[model samples]
Target: MSRYSLIRSMFRPARTTPHRCRRDIIMPFPVGRMELIVYAAVVTGLIFAAYHTTLMDYLAYQRDYIAFTTAWPSKPADFKFDMNVFLEHKRNLMEYANLEKSLMQNGTALHELKVAKLYKPLFTDIPKILLDKWVPDIERFEGVEEFLNATNFNGTIAEEFFYLEAPFFQFEHHRMAIMFPTEIKGLLMTIKIGDCYFWSTCHHTELELRDGDMHVLDVLETEDGQWNISRVYYVPAHELLKVRF
Candidate 1:
């Protein structure tokens, strides 16, 4: 061989051995059976905790929302006002009246009046017959007590006279106001205040009325689970004839 040919043969690379096929070789299990079981247990415990906590809370909230939406008194037929509900509302009114009386005696009439939800509505709706020849300057007074005092009337006299006559009075007219259980019926109407269910009833009193014939009571449940008088509509017996319903 020539020197160049010999040199080339010597420098030439040797043939590489064929690589083993890794595809055919089996690998050890990535995770043991015990490790897999532990992982599964942890995942299940997390799921159960989530269901009991977050999911339960969500479900409870949904139930409350449904209850609020599906409350009673959607219509006249759906409405109901039994003696129990009426008595509860009456009791609340009496308590409110007593509070008012106590506040007036303490000269905290303005504070009591500020908390009154019915003052504006009642004063605004005072019948023409109840007022004297001149319209009373009610605007100057801060509260019902102030208004009564300004009009030269004491709390007791005002409660007996104006309050009893006023259609929107908070308290029951009589201490033992006779409620006819048989005649008591619930009548639902469009709520003027807002979107909520309320029990309404219009019934003639067994006790004789000095002026009005019947009393219309609207009772609503407060947020604190107490029933209160939402509205009172005193209508004269003669006026009932003019009223379509």
Candidate 2:
């Protein structure tokens, strides 16, 4: 063939090289933008979820370095747990009297003063069930015998560690008041003050708003829906201990 014919034939469009549909898996020449976005999102979400789960598991087991923390059940059936449950459990854990120890031991950087608490609601360890069953007369009676009975009298833990404040006041309009008989008196006690308070009862652990600076008069709950005073003292905000009214 002449050079012109050869040049013309070469210039002629050859059959489009069959586009291998699966060859470019990493950066596929996508058919649609929507599909591409969806694929990317799914990949990203999966990666993030895996990393987050690993982080949470490590926190739960190796250290309780989380602000709100709990260990989930192993079995799927028992894992009916969710984010809300975890939040509540964690918040509850934060209310321990010895949580300072846990915080120190965990060493997860949350121990520092710069910890940021976002979107947190005000929750008090206002024991309803545990107190009622354990000591029904704590709030009803007007004497030291009732107060002593309320705190279990063993005094292993002091009155100050037993009570907490919400730390941040809200529109709930609930004044810092102690609802008890007028007969509480002559009780000299130390109070703890801070943002978080640690509480412990027979078995359960919880976080509270007890930095310090309150006498006992702390209410507690029993496992069987009983409410009683874990300790009797006075807080600065509420001084209901006057013998009169």
Candidate 3:
């Protein structure tokens, strides 16, 4: 071929086969569709995993919150008093009380002051002598009989913790309350504040109180379902020992 003819031939476009072109190439399967389906499946799996993890965490937290808040079985009257549990709670109470006392004596920082203020009411120990008189089979403790005689008490204390199912005003409205059956049959003794906020979160619910609500402090004595509101003494958090009509 002449040089000019060879140059022209080199510049001419090559004839391509219809099926050989990149754009016209057909894969054996639907590659794009397969890729899309795989991507969607992966994304869905990730989303489900995230949702499941979050749901599990939430459920665990709810369980812990409920367990921490509920002091005993649903029915307080049916609860059998376990001395070991009571003593454990008592030790915890004493520890908190001591911590508060130490804070009061030595705490100077703002946080320390706040800590002392926050737990002061929750940590106060109920008088053991009063407990001896109120608690069933409390005479099992040494000196309970002598203390009872010394106080000149004649009325019989209730054998079990009386749970108040309905909300009532005891200083503040208590959605829940447990009373230590006082020797006086138809009298309301004192109701310790039972709010989770007032008692510093769920810590109070874990305590052992007698006449008290969630915390085992001295509370009122009532017939099966009747409350003698006339004699009820409600104590606020700030004024733990002070009597409010």
Candidate with top TM-score is 2
Q: 61-142, model 1: which lDDT tens digit per residue?
A: 9998786556534543332325454445445655555554455457543433333311233332334332211111122212
Q: Which of the two candidates, 2 or 3, achieves a greater lDDT against the reference?
A: 3
RMSD after CA superposition, every candidate: 20.3, 20.9, 17.9
lDDT of each: 0.38, 0.35, 0.36
Candidate closest to the true structure, highest lDDT: 1
Model 1 TM-score relative to the real fold: 0.23
Give lDDT tens digits, candidate 3, residues 51-92.
Answer: 999999999999987865564223222223555555565455
Superposed on all Cα atoms, model 1 deviates from the true structure by an RMSD in Å of: 20.3
True-structure Cα RMSD, model 2:
20.9
Query: Candidate 1: deviation at residue 162, Å?
Result: 17
Runs in model 2 deviating more than 4 A are 1-34, 37-43, 50-54, 57-62, 65-147, 150-198, 201-217, 228-245
Q: Between the candidate structures 2 and 3, which one is better when assessed by TM-score?
A: 2
TM-score of predicted model 3?
A: 0.22
Q: Provide the lDDT at 173 for model 2.
A: 72
CA deviation > 4 Å runs, candidate 1: 1-36, 63-68, 76-245
